[model samples]
Target: MRVETVQLKGYTTLGVGGPAELWTVETPEDLKEAAQAPYRVLGNGSNLLVSDQGVPERVIKLGGVFTAWDLNLTPRNGAYITGWIGAGAMLPLLVQEAARKGLSGLEGLLGIPATVGGAVRMNAGTRYGEIADALEVVEVFHDGQLRHYRPEELGFAYRTSHLPPGGIVTRVRFRLTPSTPKAVREKMALVDQARKGQPKKKSAGCAFKNPPGDSAGRLIDVHGLKGLREGQAMVSLEHGNFIVNLGGATARDVWRLVQRIRSVIPLELEWEVWGVIE
Candidate 1:
């Protein structure tokens, strides 16, 4: 494992944040050693907003051995195929890999920029399906001890899974159904098509979770909050729920815009805030 002091803006999708001590742990033993010190596990750095002042704790990122995943195209007895994936494996690569392997279940996760562990931790999904739909077991290293947990035990809900505090997911096992190459590609295309409306700008994905029986985007749009801007951060006109970084936006700017939006309509924040927002 190697440690470096780097600007957090380069690590997150939002492109806003200050400096932090980042540790790249490549192996399980590396993770155990890193965990001995106070740390925070960072996935693909999506769906989060880190403070401009940065955090007092260290940020640990999985890599090397933790980025490996095993996927087999052929099933043993013409049944479901099981595979173990590292928490650090990027989802875009896995989605393409699965498609190439004639797998169709992950189509719903198209366009989500996240790691396997990050996707599972947040139950990342769209209308087609969720990551939890095919998940079986999650292996995590917590408090210097390794443990296996079923999905039910994690309390999976919409866009969120309740993992114990300081629990670092090391790997995950998934069960997927095989399909024809053409069919799998088609499903992925459809899922991608559905996501075409999302903003292409720098953002931490959706800014607010959809309230039950209602969408935060719809609410924001209906309230005429589209195009709302604070500093360099703005509510995307394409999708009201997205707060886009219009270049050089600060974390405080995004949070101020978020507060502006929240003032008009009550919506729960979907993005996990790091450090203080004020």
Candidate 2:
């Protein structure tokens, strides 16, 4: 609805970035009206490494009608617990709600940070599970038209869901397993306990997707890269996959570090480390 210069730090979980110039749209109608312009969507900014130079155009972010969630329990066919979840609903909140409603599947996804749409798009999850497993269908708006993709049609990959290119997710329908609330809470607590010792400050979850059997953090740690610093950006000592911004880090510093890591890993182990950045 309103366009302006945005400091990337405010939106990202990493607390590092520069700026995005142009309007930010909060509604689908607003997005449609400005469809002629080049744009990108930003969610809760959990898993992104923004450029220091910033994107040169509009970044449409859905809000308002975009952020509602509805839960339904169908008694037919073994108590199917379906949730019509909004794109902007926070992932943690969804997990919390699911646990409250006796949904067993989302317990492993407790500490993730992002809107439901972003989680669905990226297929965010831990080693134990991923969001796509429980997704039934997702509603998206693309090229001024609305469409729905069932789980089978969505093309769930390692960390990607093959939604139509340029499609903005509006809502997700998830069919969850019915379990006792106590059982769900216990599982959630286990996930929480695992996350408790990790640094809780600014971070973008895991910086790199794991390379099959090997973890990115383990690789970086083996290289003696823990607490490695460049300007204010430092690879976290506790978790090598995370790059922490100690107060005043720039996107360039983070990008340079990522480049350095990628270039060095192969030279050290003769193994390629692939990752995505935006």
Candidate 3:
């Protein structure tokens, strides 16, 4: 285990937050120690927003072996390819691996910048598919006890999965169909194409979850809230549901903009916030 005072802004995709004590844990025992410290886990920091003032809790980051995944598929069953993946592995790495190995799952998650553990815990997905579709079991280390769970036990929803408070995903099992590399790459390309027009600027992806039978972006667009700004934070003109950092935006700016949109549309937030804001 290692500890450092890291500027959280440098870690998050949205590019906000200040300094906080961050622990990098490489072993299972290290994870337990950090959890017992009541530390919060940080992955790729996608779909997350931290305070410019700094995070309230000590943060835990995975490194070393955690970032490694083993898919060694010399398939006994020609129909399916399965493997245990590390929590710290990025989604794009899996997507690329899937393409190379001709695995026909996780291709739809091509553009999401998320860690395997975080993505699975939240059931992250696109319109094409979700992590749950490929997920079989999750290996979790919580309160110094290791446990496993299936998709049904996690109570997965559109973009939510119920993990015990302070639970940390250690690894996961993914079952994927065996397809030709050409086919998998085609699917990946299709997913990439579907994601066009999102803002290229710094962001935490979609700020709000889509409401039932309606898209939050559509409603925000209908309300003419696109291009709305609060300090350096602004609703992206490209996509209404996205709050883009114009540059040097504080966490408060983003939170204030979120409140501004919620005042009008009453949408639920999708991004997980790590600090209190006034």
Candidate 4:
């Protein structure tokens, strides 16, 4: 029943927002109660854009009690390992955990900043990888109850998981093939290296999903939108698809820049770009 004001700019990766009325949920029961409070669920706050006017609504953020990790080995499929990871667990932590356990599937998502729940919702991935591929089942809370959904039921697709909107993922089970820990580490290092080449400042990761057979950054770069700035929000000089906060960026600034890019790209190069913004 505790309500606090949140400085959302500090809470999000974008670093540009006002404040939210927030409540911290420490347990599933707490989450259930908070979910009924007309608030948006806030996970690691990486893939969202908040209005500068701020989130006038209540926000529910879950904490570490939901971050448990468990592993079990199976005999039927050449040392398959099953990981039951909590939704509140950070993506990088889960990646490293799976790597340490000699599981080979999640190495491609090494440096992404988000929680498992967010990753499950967005099906977050790079060109060669996705979290949904390795998922066997997802435990979720919806409609005031908890349920498990198999992969087929999840309807996973590019950059999206087909959970009914507003459903909260509580845990995810992964099916992984066992490999040598050294091998897993090598693959993860490669992913880290690739990510290191991108902008590493205050950003909301990729601003646009790549269109089929082409890259979003390449298109934006071709249009010369890289390094474009408006009120402290700059289109990254290093990666066009990313807009970085340059000390005083606001949500309106970011939104305007995105619209400018989208408006020009279609007319100039006949390329369609869609951005996910709040």
RMSD of each: 1.5, 3.7, 1.5, 3.6
lDDT of 2 by residue, 159-218 (tens): 777888888888888877889899999987877877654666577777777877888888
Q: lDDT tens string, model 4, 11-47?
A: 7888876778888777888888888766677778787
For residue 183, give model 3's deviation from the true position in Å.
0.5
Q: What is the lDDT of residue 145 in candidate 2?
A: 82
Output the lDDT of residue 6, model 3.
Answer: 94
Candidate achieving higher TM-score, 2 or 3: 3
Relative to the unseen true structure, what is the C-alpha lDDT of residue 91 in candidate 3, on a scale of 0 to 100?
Answer: 83
**Residue 224 lDDT (model 1):** 96
**Candidate 1's error at 26, in angstroms?**
0.5
Of 2 and 4, the candidate ranking higher by lDDT = 4
Count clashing residue pairs per candidate: 0, 2, 0, 0
Worst 10 residues of 2 by lDDT: 267-276
Q: Clashing pairs in model 4?
A: none
Error of 2 at 57 (Å): 2.2
Name the candidate, 2 or 3, with the larger lDDT value: 3
Off by over 4 Å in 1: 73-79
Question: TM per model?
Answer: 0.96, 0.89, 0.96, 0.91
lDDT, each prediction:
0.89, 0.75, 0.87, 0.79
